[model samples]
Target: MCIQTELQRFQTEFNQTLVQTFSQLPNDIAPKLHQAMEYSVSNGGKRLRPFLLQIMAKVLAIDPKLIQPAAVALECIHSYSLVHDDLPAMDDDDLRRGKPTCHIQFDEAHAILAGDALQTLAFELLINADVQTDIKLSWVKILAQASGYQGMCGGQSLDLEAENKSVGLESLANIHSLKTGALLKAAVSMGCAAQRNLSDEQKQKFERFAELIGLAFQIQDDILDVTATTDALGKPQGSDQKSNKSTYPSLLGLTGAVHKAEQVFQSALEQIEDLPYNTQPLMDFAQFIIKRQH
Candidate 1:
C-alpha cells in the first residue's frame, strides 16, 4: 500500500481501538472526571507516538493485538502530559486540537485529576497486557523514565527556565531531548520490546532513528509556529513567540531552521537503513513530520 493509504488505515484502526479501550473504563468512576478524561483522549491530535508504536510492531511482524495495549497506553501518557502542560501553572494555553483545553472545558481541579487518572491508567493497561513478566517490567521502567522526572517533565522544567533567556543551541537541544524526545524514543523502544527477537544493537539503531526524528519534529513545530495559520495548525499560531520561549527560529533564522530540519530528517533515514525490514513507512513518517502543518 502507499504511505498515505497505510497512514489513513492505521489512523482509523487506532481511533477505533482507542475508543473501545476507553469504553472499558468502569462506569463507577465519578461522572465529571470520567467525562473530562474521555473528552481529552477522544479529542484528537495526530496520534503520532501510538502510530509509531503500531507501525513498528507491524514491521517486526508482532501480533497487532499485542501492540494495541502499548499503543493506547502511550497515547494516554501523551494526552496526560498535554493536559498538565496546558494547565495554568504550565504552558497556560486555552486551546488544543482546535478545542478548549481540558482545564478550560472543565475546571482546573477536574483537569488535574483527569491527567492524573490518565497517567495511572497507562500503567494499568500495560501491566494487564498479555505479555511476559520481564518484558512488561522493562516496558514499565522505560515508560516511567521517559514520561517522569528524567524525561518529558524534566524537559518542561528546563523549557520554563529558558524562557526570556538567550539559550545556546546545545542547551536548547538538551532541553528538547528530554522534553520531546524522551517519550518519542520510548515509543520506538516499546515497540521493539514487544518483539522478543530483536537484538540489543538493532534496538539501539531504531532508538537513534527515533531520537533524530523527535528533534526534527520539534524543529518543524517551531517552523509551523512562524509559517502556518491557526486554522491549519489547530492551535494558536506563533504561541511560541508570544510566550517568548526559545525556538529554532529564534536562534537560527527561518532558512537555517529549515535546513537544520532537513539535516536531521536525512540522518534519521540513514540510521534505519541497515535494518532488515522495508522501511518505507518509517521514511515516509519522517517526511510527514517535516511537512506537516500542525
Candidate 2:
C-alpha cells in the first residue's frame, strides 16, 4: 500500500481505537480529572508513537487483538509526557495541536495532576495487558527507564538548562537522544517487545534506528517551525524560536540542519537493511518524517 494510504488508515484507526479506550474508563475516577484526561489524550496530534507501535506489530503479522494493549499503553505514556511538557514549569505554551494547551484549558495544577495520572496509567495498562508476565515485565522496565529521570525527564531538564546556551554536538546529541529519541526508541522497543521476535543484536539495531529517526524527527520539527504555517502545523509556527530554545536550525544554519536531519534519516534507514523484509512501514514512516512540513 502507498505511504499516504497507510498513514491515513493508521491515523483513522488509531484515533478511533484511542477514543474507545478512553471511553472505557470509569467515571468515578474524578469527573474533572477524567475530563482533563480526555482533553489531553483526545487532543489532535499525529499520534506517531502508537501508530508506529501498531505498524511494527503489523510488520510482525501479529493479531490486532493481541497488540491493542501494548499500543494503547504506548499512547498513554506519550500523552502523559505531552501533558507535563505543556505545563507552566515546562514548555509553558498556550497552544497544542492548534487548541488550548492542557494547562491553559484546565489550569496548571490539574494539568500536572493529569500528567501524573497518565504516567501511572501507562504502567497500569502495560501490567494489565493480556500478555505474558515476562513480556509485561520487560516492557514495563523499558518504558519506565525511558520516561524516568534518566530519559525523557532528564532530557527535558537538560533542555531547560541548555536554552540560550551554546553546546557541542555530543552534548546536543545527548539531549535529543534523551528528550525525543528516548520515546521513539521506546516505541520501537515496545513493538519488538510485543513480538518477542527480535534477537539481542536486532534489538540493538532497532534502538539505533529509533535514535536516528527520533533526532531527525525533531530536526524536521525545527525546520517546520521556520518554514510552515500555523494552519499547516496545527500549532504556532516559530514557537520554539519564540521560546529561545537551541535547535539544529539555530546552531547549524537551515541548510546545515537539513543536512543533519538527512544524515540521521539515512543512518536509521540503513539499520533495517540487514533485517528481514519487515521494514516497509518503518521506511515509510521515516520518509514521512523527513518530508513532512508539519
Candidate 3:
C-alpha cells in the first residue's frame, strides 16, 4: 500500500479509538472539563508521535493492537503538552489545529485543569492496558521522564529562558533536544521495549533514528513558521519570531536551515537502513517530516 493510504487508514483507526477512550470517562466527571479534553485531543493534527510508535511497533514485528494503548498514551501526553504550551502563561497562542486553543475556547483555569487531566489520564491508560507488568513499567518510566523535568518540561524551560536573548547554535539545539526531542525518542523506545527479541544495540539504533528525525522535525517547524501562511500552519505565522525565540532559521540562515533539515533527515535514514524490516514506510514518513509545509 502507498504510504499516504496507510497513514490515512492508521489515522482513521486511531481517531476512533481515541473517541471511544474519551467516551468511557466516568459520568460523574465535570461535563465542561470532559468536553475540553475531548476538544483538545480530538482536534485535527498529524498524529505524528502515535504514528511513529505504531510504525516502530510494526518494524519490531509487534502487533499494532498490542501497542495501541501505548500509542494512545503517548498521544495524550503530546496533546497535553500542546494544551499547556498554548496557555497564556506559556506560548500564549490563540489557535491550535485550526481551532481556538483550549484556553480560548473555554477559559484559562479550565484549560489548565484539562491539561492536568490529560497528563494523568495518559499514565492511567498505560497502567490499565492489558500488557505485561514489565512492559507497563517500562512505558511508564519512559513517558514520565520524557514528559517531566528531564525532558519536555526541561526543554520548555530552556526555551522560555532563551527568549529575546542572543543564543548560539549549540544552545538552541540543546533547548530543542530536551523540549521536542524527548517525547519523540520515548515513542520509538517504547515500541522497542514492546518487542522481546530485540537487542539493546538495535534499540539504540531506533532511538538514534528518532533523535535525528526529532531535530529535523523542529527545524521544519521553524522553517514553516517563517514561510508558511497562518492557514497552512494552523497557528500564527512567525509566532516564534514575534515571541523573540531563537529558531533554526534565526541561527542558521533560511537556506542553511533548509540544508540542515535535509542533512538531519539523511542521517535519520542511515539509522534504519540496516534494520531487518520493510523500512519504506519509515523512510517515507521521515521524508515527509522535513518536507512538510506545516
Instruction: Find the candidate with the highest TM-score and give its number.
Output: 3
| Candidate 1 C-alpha lDDT tens digits along 13-73 | 8889877887798656688988888888887668889888877877888888887888888
TM-score of each: 0.97, 0.95, 0.98
Error of 3 at 52 (Å): 0.5
Q: What is the lDDT for 196 in model 2? A: 68
Which rank order by lDDT, best down to worst? Answer: 3, 1, 2
Model 2, residue 85: what's the lDDT?
85
Runs off by more than 4 Å, candidate 2: none
Candidate 1: Cα lDDT at 137: 88
lDDT to native, each model: 0.89, 0.83, 0.90
Worst 10 residues of 1 by lDDT: 1-10
